[model samples]
Target: MELFADRAEAGALLAERLPDARDPVVLALPRGGVAVAVPVARRFGAPLDVLVTRKIGYPPQPELGVGAIAEGGEPVFDLALLHRLGLTPESVAGVVEEERRELARRVRAYRGERALPPLEGREVIVVDDGLATGGTARAALRAVAAAKPARVTLAVPVGARGTVEALRQEADEVVALLTPVDFRAVGQWYEHFEQLSDEDVLDLLGAA
Candidate 1:
């Protein structure tokens, strides 16, 4: 079954299950998650903000995320994976630098001069299109937690069971619409899972 037609549709459907929050704010992982977050923010009539995180992928295998970095937070490494890959801070410094540069560009593009909304003592809902390794999500959660939110809910339309379970430890609450054991990839659950560009992200934020 097609769980979602697209990110927008997924966001709308996911909004139905979210609790009616007080003093809530929606923070989205930019590029794709922004699409999934727009409706959720609208559903609660809450303020929307961007929570940017960049994946630190393995060298020569850019798709394999070994760690992630969020703005204003230290890089969160998968120590076990790093050991297995024989990667160290010195080894991945180049990749981290590359991702950091891209992350900065994205922050500028999506946020521009607007300031990040205050998260302290607020009900923060972090929305993403889906969770795979959960590396980026983990980094984002840690960054948000450092700001001392009253509560943090990690919300997603779908995710692998193991990844979702691991995320529960980082978040105050975990809300995933689909936790299929047979999960292969996030895009597999959606009929239209197109990659989101920087312009797309900015457009969504602008409309919100």
Candidate 2:
């Protein structure tokens, strides 16, 4: 039961495990990843940026995520779950559109007019708090892969062992400090896993 005190502490630990790269860049999955990436960015002297990926939740229970959309990628859904719920992509069209708008808004607010930094031939490290189901991380990795970076690593403080293993296929490297087998929810591995506001994300980005 390794529990992190907070995102900053977790980020500090993760920073140590990251490998040195050639002209590195750190892109965080914003709202939460920004905090965790600040220290990593500092460690690598990498420019910190946001890669917005909004979750497409179940229509009735908005917290129950079924898919995610990354900044430069289409919505990725769990087909098995969709079938089980008797839903399809067309049925969730509205949800996808809503999340797309929100993702665009976040990208605008975070990056302004500046586009994603040069990723081709550079090591791109994507940081997030943790992986629950890994839908968001998968979408983000695919989006990053499209840019054809030299390499892309997905870094996290803690994750389910199975999820981390699954994400290894999506990333060149998947770094999780604590991949406990008993993992349930990501928050359970943290002592204080408060939801970060958009302002908090901006503050971290500015500070880094």
Candidate 3:
């Protein structure tokens, strides 16, 4: 239906729809999520940070994500997909380990030794650019949940409706600007969905 011109436009629109935050902090899933989250953090006057997670993609077709793991969290998989693919967790162990390594590398590059902020009594809003399978978001939310936030919200610009609905189990609230029925890929909803480099994410974080 509707399309977002870019991640910034999506972020601005998403920020407009976000609820008032009482002592909140915005943690974005980089590198695209950083762009979508800058405005949201500005809207709430909250601190901005990055949360690194990586999707565990099918080995033969890396773009076909089967699961994900956040930097310090256990892997999460779509068991149904695994079954359909005639795969098992044990079979995909190598892929899981590889993604975990990449996740750690990203965490080191993004935040260094800095740990996640104290979220014990704050509203932690986890922002992402969009959701396809939502594997990464699921892992990210669970990681944040372990830190004992008073509430956790997963915010995205656009997403597949089914994935958006399924993510409700992971967060205290889920905020998606658009959940289109015909969602095939997240890039299809944007005209300028360019690949973001780590430097780009750093720049966004610095500006925020």
Candidate 4:
């Protein structure tokens, strides 16, 4: 597997190939995505913002994402997965309710009542550290779309080849540095794949 020394290096490399566009904004998925996005935002000289999203996981297997919840309570469900798991509407609702609470908390902590900047008629790039199931990325795209951006792009340093291809349909464009066919998990591509805490997310945004 290919390796990145850290997120800063990865962001710089990804930023190098992005097109120069006017009024561009970089919206990053927290908490790992923020680390990866900092350098890209700095390099592109674009405003940096956070796109908060939470995955709706199966009750039994919490890691298996069945859908995702974006800001403003927008939800995108994976019907096939829900059907296969035999998850009832009530069960799904419960999961969504819990995730919504978390999402609200994150938004308040990250943005503090500040309205999200207008994306209408502007170029917006959504950045994530990596793509796995693509649930969070899809939710982010949907949230950004609501603002009527002229174009939406998904930028990542590494991702599973299949996942990246599938996500392309959801965004106007996708830019990925590495697409590994044998991908197991996103962490495999990074040397220091440490988990970021809420404090870390808050601190990063505060500094920016």
| lDDT digits (tens) for residues 125-201 of candidate 3 | 99999999899999999988888888999999999999999999889999998899999989999999999999899
lDDT value for candidate 4? 0.88
Q: RMSD, each candidate, Å?
A: 1.1, 1.0, 1.2, 1.3
Residue 192 in candidate 2, Cα distance off native in Å: 2.0
CA lDDT scores, all candidates in order: 0.91, 0.92, 0.92, 0.88
The model with the greater lDDT, 3 or 4, is 3
lDDT tens per residue, model 1, 1-208: 5579999999999999898789799999987899999999999999888999999999888899999999867889998999999888778998989989988887888888666798899999999999989999999999999999999999999999999999999998999999998999999999999998888888898898
Candidate 2: worst 10 consecutive residues by lDDT? 17-26
Model 4, position 31: C-alpha lDDT score: 91
Give one clash count per candidate, in the order shown: 0, 0, 0, 0
Clashes of 4: 0
Pick the winner on lDDT between candidates 1 and 4.
Answer: 1
Cα distance off (Å), candidate 3, residue 130: 0.6
**Candidate 2: what lDDT?**
0.92
Residue ranges of candidate 4 with Cα displaced over 4 Å: 88-90
Residue runs of model 3 more than 4 Å from their true location after superposition: none
Task: Kindly indicate the candidate among 2 and 4 with the higher lDDT.
Answer: 2
Off by over 4 Å in 2: none
